[model samples]
Target: MGLWDDLKMQYRMGGITQRLIFWNIGVFLVSLIFYEFRLGTFIFPDWLALSSDPLVLAIHPWTLLTYAFLHSGFLHLLFNMLVLNYAGMLFLTFFKEKQLVGLYILSAIFSGIIFCGAYFLMGRVSIIVGASAAIMAILVAATTYSPHMPIRLLLIGRVQLWHMTAVILIIDLMQLMIENTGGHISHLAGAFFGFTYIKLLQTGTDLSKIVTGTVDGVLRMFKPSQPKPFKKVHRNYNTQPRSTTASKTAVKDKKQQQIDEILDKISRSGYDSLTQQEKDFLFNAGK
Candidate 1:
């Protein structure tokens, strides 16, 4: 399959990360068309974009989550989606697919609530849109889980994930008073969630469990029930065929399992700690 077909298959397979990326992009394109026609950011209805005003939100509470999907401009949308895709992949290195989706949703709502509280405290009203808070949450949460993991960068050769997380978070803190107070407030809130989520997880509490159960419940509701047909219980292990397809699938599954184990090792220690054989496996897999 081509790149497009592969993406379609991924979407159909319901990978949470890819689905979020596609949803953001889809929303961005529609917003862009409306933006051109409506003359400005007003293209997005107030109902879809969150407001710092408590009164406005009281009337349209759903904006807390929906606002995250709308972006102010193309560059804003592009940067957010890029970061989300990168951080999200890194996040999945040690976490389940459901956790990422839950983090994004919970972070957005947390950020919105923080933004509203700040507005109320400061007696200000403003509009807010973007996925920065949720993206920040994913980036920070992944770093917290694998703080020592070394990530290669373009200009900066290699840096620990914790180092990057600290710098970005400090920047967000320092910018809180500069402008866009609500946005900065939201960012901080999301960061707090990310940090605490990891801390709580270390204590044996998985905050995403509730969200995961909800997702499973929804899926079960949609899944068609299988009928129970008559079955013969006679065992005949020697009569089973050794199919090539089944063997190939088993080989593929083994390779994937090996890859996952190597990734988990790298997450616990730095990439440099990887064995030569492990490094070669990653190298070949990348190819």
Candidate 2:
């Protein structure tokens, strides 16, 4: 296969957040290539980029959404992508694909709003760019989902998930007293949305639903669906499946045996001794 095809295949295998990282990186590279060709000015149109100018923003309100995908430098993109990768994987472990997508778009929009609002309040006339705010949102969401999960830091032994979250929040809070106070404020806003979103989800209410509905509406507008004809099915014979008491007892006995074996292993080696596969199996069995 050609190089482009190979890259596309690899991207297809990546998770939702990974796909987003690829898109952002692709945009950056394309911009660089255009710059080399002396066409960099067209990379991300000024109209599309977020601006603090009231006149420009009023003319193009969509900048709030587009700005989240534009990064200023390589290191900036790298940091954001790293955070996104880590948090997105954790989110995927519990959320369905649809929910993951919804969360991402909602997080991005919320982050954009925070960034723009902070910029205006800080009296800065510069445009806001980068995925940091959205990345922060994902990190906060993951922390909220499993606060007790273990996380190993370099040169710092394993720490509880909440501890890492506390450290991050503290750092962001501290940054508010520095030159990039606006960015820090945006991060805080994203983090708040993340935490609140997860809490609401647990209680069966998702704010992301509004974003999801909007996306569905747009998709349907582009690709209208046609109703399909339905056919009825008729069953020929009525027969009851037979149940054997001996077979039922045997099945129950086998399950009990498996449970006993797992309990014995846990008793002898401790829960941490079990592999992830084993732990998952035990968890599912208990469920």
> What are the TM-scores, per candidate, against the unseen true structure?
0.74, 0.71
Highest TM-score model number: 1
The TM-score obtained by model 1 is 0.74
lDDT of 2 by residue, 1-287 (tens): 34564455446535577688997898777655433222322335556567767778889888776677777667777888888778777777677666766776677777767666667776776666667777777778888999898988889999988898889999999879776675777678878888988999999998777878888889999996788979889886735444675687889899789868866776566444656566555555654
> Candidate 1 residues 1-287, lDDT tens each?
34564445446443567689899989877776555334444456677889888778999999999989988877778889889888998899899888888889888999999988888888888889999999999999999888999998889889988888898888888988997778888888998898888889899998888777888999999999999989879866665467976897899999999989987876576455766677667666755
Residue runs of model 1 more than 4 Å from their true location after superposition: 1-7, 10-15, 32-43, 221-287
Q: For each candidate in the order shown, give its overall lDDT on alpha carbons.
A: 0.83, 0.73
The lowest-lDDT stretch of 10 consecutive residues in candidate 2 is 34-43
